[model samples]
Target: MSFVIAVDGPAASGKGTVASGLARELGLPHLDSGLLYRAVGRALQVAGGDPDDAAAATETARRLDPHDLEDPALRTREAGEAASRVAVHAGVRAALLDFQHAFAAQEPGAVIDGRDIGTVIAPDAPAKLFVTASPEVRAHRRWLQLKDQGVSLDEILADIALRDERDSARSTAPLVQAKDAVLLDTSEMTIEQAADAARRIVEAARARWETSLKGEASQKG
Candidate 1:
């Protein structure tokens, strides 16, 4: 029985860093699911497709080569914005769903982080965490990150707000907390503290999964 930890959160919520730390602590593979959407956006841009064209976005997603997604250029603000636009398309989300699920099923277990991982992609995951922070805090975090990259702080804050609205209002798999997921508010927490708390949750879930698996095996035996 493979153990899966699904971490869901909005942008700049620190979920990604927490997920990576938990995965490292547990020796599990970590999948940043947002990368899938960004890959499609980057692909479309490179192919000269308009970001606002849903049909073009869907086609790009359908034909996406995960290998090509490894380009460091995909991590830029422009690509992230483009990805948010494409992510609202149902076809684009559907195209990337299977790849995320496959990664979650890998051996020893896996840690997956994204907007919908806990709710839509890995609902049955043994451990589910919904990490978040106040919108102001999230925006501030994004502002600083972009500022460090030489971007204007005011523009970055406005973009963060817009992206948050778009992500939460999308019809398909909108970002929301899963009912059974543990909610971690990192509004004032350090990365190490968030990671430690998440590790404790995962450890508890792993124990439960092991116990359940043992019971099933005993019944079969």
Candidate 2:
């Protein structure tokens, strides 16, 4: 039985950082599934394709090179906005689903983070977390990150709001907490605290998994 940890959250909610930290702690592979959408968006932009064209985006997503997806340029606000726009396309989401699932299947276990990881991408994952924070807090965090990169604070805040609206309003895979997912509100938690809380959740899930396996073995015997 493969173990998977699905971390879902909105932009700047700290899911990515927490997921990465948990994966490192557990010696597991980590997948930032948002990068898959960003990669498709970037590829579409490079091809001069229409961001609203679902078919074009899906085709681009199907052939995306994971290597090209890691370019630092994808981290820019423009790329993020474009990615959010393209993410509304159902076809594009479908195209990348299998790739995300395949990554989660890697042995020992794997951690995947994105808006829909717990709900859409890895619904069966034993450990599912929905990390979130107030919009103001999230905006402030994004503002600080962009400020370090020389982007204006006002522009960063505006971009954050716009991205939040788009992500929450998208028709396909709109950002929402999965019914069975454990919610972690990070509004008052430091990164270290949030990561530690997430680690505890995963540890509890791991314990359950082991006990279940032991029961199965006893039944077989």
Candidate 3:
């Protein structure tokens, strides 16, 4: 049935939680595409290669195993910084493109979450969601997760805002919502509420697609 769910959002926007929860409920494979860049960054860091070296980053990305993507350290601030740098490299992005696409085409369905899933990775996906929240709200959520006591509030907010600018301003596969994606503003909503909304949107689209198919079959008959 090739049902694909593309979920896109900036960091700490609740798309990851909603996408993971939705994938569990729907029994589909979930791919966190951002992790690809994170994995490459971590690998390069481990190998003592420079993140700014496009050739090294591209090689690291191409050789990245699924196990590399599973590193718990990939979630660190240093890894995020490394990823942001290398992800802007054209060669690095080209190297990892196939892996994301293959993951998105798995058996019955798949759910992909990233800043560019809807815009670049899975433009043909039937269901697309753009999750977002105000910078203050997202910053608070991120601060809670990192729990860095020494960092000032202004630092945290500025970091988040900087990441937003870097992500959106990048020339390659910049983070922007597909025109047809359903916007999910989770500024005031719980993760459960967001997941419920995502499920409803995908289900309704599936129903419409199925109905259209049945209509065609009837016409042929």
Candidate 4:
């Protein structure tokens, strides 16, 4: 069985960093699932479509080429905001469902990070983490990443707050923590510390998974 790890959290929560690091340590492929949404959003923007148009956003998501995710433009703040808008559409979420599932079904396993990875995309993943940090800290971190663009810290903080509200209030696959997931609050931790804590969590989950497999085998003997 593939040992899938689903990492879910709000924007700027450092879930992506943790997921990528864990994937490397475990020799598993990693998927930054948010990039898929960002691609859809960016495409819609370039086409002059309104993000709130469910049909248009859904079509954009359906037609998204995996290669489009490599576009560096999708990493920008504008693309991220657009993604948040499009993501609220149930149709858009439905369109991308299969893509995420396929990634988790790969050999060995995979590490996937996004808002709904644990609660919606990969609920049965063996290792699930819900990473988070305080809003102020998260805003600060995000500002640091984009300060070169001349965006003010206050503007970024407000944007983060709006995104959080939208994500949690969305009707479809809302951002939430899975009941079985371990929560890692990185509010005060350094990147290295957060990564270390994530490794320990996954290691524990892996051991439990192996023991369950052994128990099943013994029962069949």
Candidate 5:
């Protein structure tokens, strides 16, 4: 079986950065799962479809091309909101499940980062991280990323709070930490510090995983 590292968290929580670092450190491919949803949402928006319409969102997700993931529009604030909205539908999630699963099944291993990766997408992953930070800290990071847009820090904080509620309260595949996952709070940490901490956590998990595999092999022998 391939090694899968599941990194999950809410918006702007540094999960994406940490996941990328892990992939590079482990020599694995990294998949930003949120981009899938963002692409679906952007496509639906382009088609004049409402995100609240489950059928429309599901259809948009079904037709989503892997190429769409590279569209720069998907990185905008509007795209993020739309993604969160469409993500509430179970149908939309089902439509994108295969794409995510295929990425995680690649040879060698893979790193997947998203809200539900640990809880729903890759529950059996040997290494799982629930990365998070205070809303203010997350908002600050997001503001720095989009500061040129002239958006106020307060507005950014409000949006983060709204997304948090929507993501956590959604009925399907809500943002949550799996019981076996380690939590990394980056509220007061720099990017380098967080990356180093994440490396340590994954290294520990990998050791345990190797040991378990060896134990199983001995029992079989």
Candidate 6:
């Protein structure tokens, strides 16, 4: 059996960093589930397909190669918007569902991070964290990241707000924290601080899950 850690959050939150840190601490493989949608979105852009066209978007997702996810372009604002657009299609989401599930079921364990990992992809995961920050704090982080590249803080803030709206309002796999997920608000927390807190949470959750499993085994035996 595999232990799964599902970390879900909106754009620009520290989920990716926290997930990476947690995976390193736990010796588990990590998957950025959003990259799957970004891959499809990039494919659509390359093929001149309309993101709003469900059939086109679904076809793009169905034909996606895992290699395509390695593209650095998927991290761009345009690609993120495209991803949000294509992700609204249920068929597109279904096309990528199995891929995400396979990643989560890896031997030993896995850490998967994205908007819907907790609520949809890995609802039974042993550790689920909903990482978030205020829009202002997240936007500031983005600004600091791209300031040298000539992007404005105001533009980044607007983009973050708009992306949040689209992601939360999407029909399929909307951005929502699962009921049992522990919330990690990083608005006032530094990266090191966030990672420390996350480590504690996952350790506790994993202990509980392992105890439950042992109890079940005893009952069965």
* Order of quality (TM-score): 4, 5, 6, 1, 2, 3
Candidate 1 deviates by what RMSD? Answer: 1.5
Task: Give each model a TM-score.
Answer: 0.94, 0.93, 0.93, 0.99, 0.98, 0.97
Q: Which has the higher lDDT value, candidate number 2 or candidate number 4?
A: 4
Best by lDDT: 4
Candidate 6 local lDDT, 6-36, one digit each (tens): 9999988999999999999889999998899
TM-score of 1: 0.94
lDDT of each: 0.87, 0.87, 0.87, 0.95, 0.94, 0.92
- lDDT by residue (tens digit), candidate 1, 155-181: 777887898899999999999999989
Question: Cα RMSDs of all predictions?
Answer: 1.5, 1.5, 1.7, 0.7, 0.8, 1.1
Least lDDT summed over 10 consecutive residues: which range in candidate 3?
Answer: 147-156
Clash-forming residue pairs, model 2: none
Angstrom error at residue 207, model 2? 1.1
Query: Residues 94-208, candidate 5, lDDT per residue (tens digit)?
Result: 9999999999888878999999999888899999999999999999999998888788899999999999999999999999899999999999999999999999999999899
Collision pairs in model 3? none
Q: Tens digit of lDDT per residue, candidate 2, span 97-194?
A: 88887897888779999998888888889899999998788888887766777787677767778888888898888998999889999999999999
The per-candidate count of clashes, in order, stands at: 0, 0, 0, 0, 0, 0
Q: Which has the higher TM-score value, candidate number 1 or candidate number 5?
A: 5
Residue 158 of candidate 3: its Cα lDDT?
A: 86
Q: What is the per-residue lDDT of model 3 for residues 71-92, given as tens digits with 9 covering 90 to 100?
A: 8998877787788888888899
List candidate 5 segments past 4 Å from native: none
**Higher-lDDT candidate of 2 and 6:** 6
Poorest lDDT segment (10 consecutive residues) of candidate 5: 143-152
